[model samples]
Target: MTIREHNGVGKVTWKAEPDAHDYPAAASYLSLIAPGAQAGDLVGQLQTASLEHYKAKDMLRASGLPLLPPDNPHVAADLAKVKNNKALSPVLLIRGDLTLGIALQIADGYHRVCASYHLDENTDIPCRIADHPGSRVSALAAAVGGDLVNDSR
Candidate 1:
């Protein structure tokens, strides 16, 4: 694999996708893209929770990221979409020492989770959790389309 540098950081090109369950381990290496971020071992664990809208709001607020009212057109639209179809993927979350003390910063599917929570205070949210210190977006972004190894297949 060719090693390339971006902004003075070297990374080995991934030739294939790692197992879906290995996200946490991969995230630790990927955190190099952003300083003060860390990803812990995968728990191989998941759970369903009925999170409240206010709680979701609080969760997002604690993330230290700009808060978008659940009623925002896009948020509302996504909420409606989720209400109509509850078959979407789980909400992805990340947590780590440097991350805000918020319960878990949303790594992916924030809008969808918000919508789910807004639609029903007791909405059943399936979340794939991880321990990571990267900014919410960066953590998930790397997994989806950044320099970190991914399931490109």
Candidate 2:
């Protein structure tokens, strides 16, 4: 869906298939951070994100697409194996405009994206998208923080 300002209310133009590759950086980052977040909540957050922040996140995700040596090589290797085996997980989290903005600010899922790239340079995993409308970066960050805490154990 495309988001535009119309008559003061935000306008969303839905598409049959979302262009995952075309996703804005911030929203994508939020999806990576939340993993399985609700679409509605994500949209709400995206709507609230500042344009500059959103663009910054998008640039970060894009720049990190290529994996370099000595940085999470194990994860990168795991991604490669998954790609080689054709067994990469299908579940993905996609976000709309607002959540995308918040994600850009938090820079979530750098490792995961890098790993995914390492595994299969051409793989496009299925994503479950969120559409945040009125959320903030701190809230998204908190959600990511919780995930980190949970994964640490």
Q: Mark the regions of model 1 whose C-alpha exceeds 4 Å error after superposition.
A: 1-58, 61-67, 98-103, 133-153
TM-scores of the candidates in the order shown: 0.42, 0.32
Please report how far candidate 2 places residue 92 from its true position, in Å.
3.3
Q: Residue 56 deviation, candidate 2, in Å?
A: 17
lDDT of 2 by residue, 78-107 (tens): 445443442322222333234344432223
lDDT by residue (72-135, candidate 1, tens digit) is 8867776554444323444555544344444455655566556644544334444454444335
lDDT of model 2 at position 87: 33
**Candidate 1 Cα lDDT to native:** 0.44
Question: Which residue runs of candidate 2 sit more than 4 Å off their true CA positions?
Answer: 1-74, 83-86, 94-100, 104-112, 119-122, 133-153
Give per-model CA RMSD.
16.9, 15.3
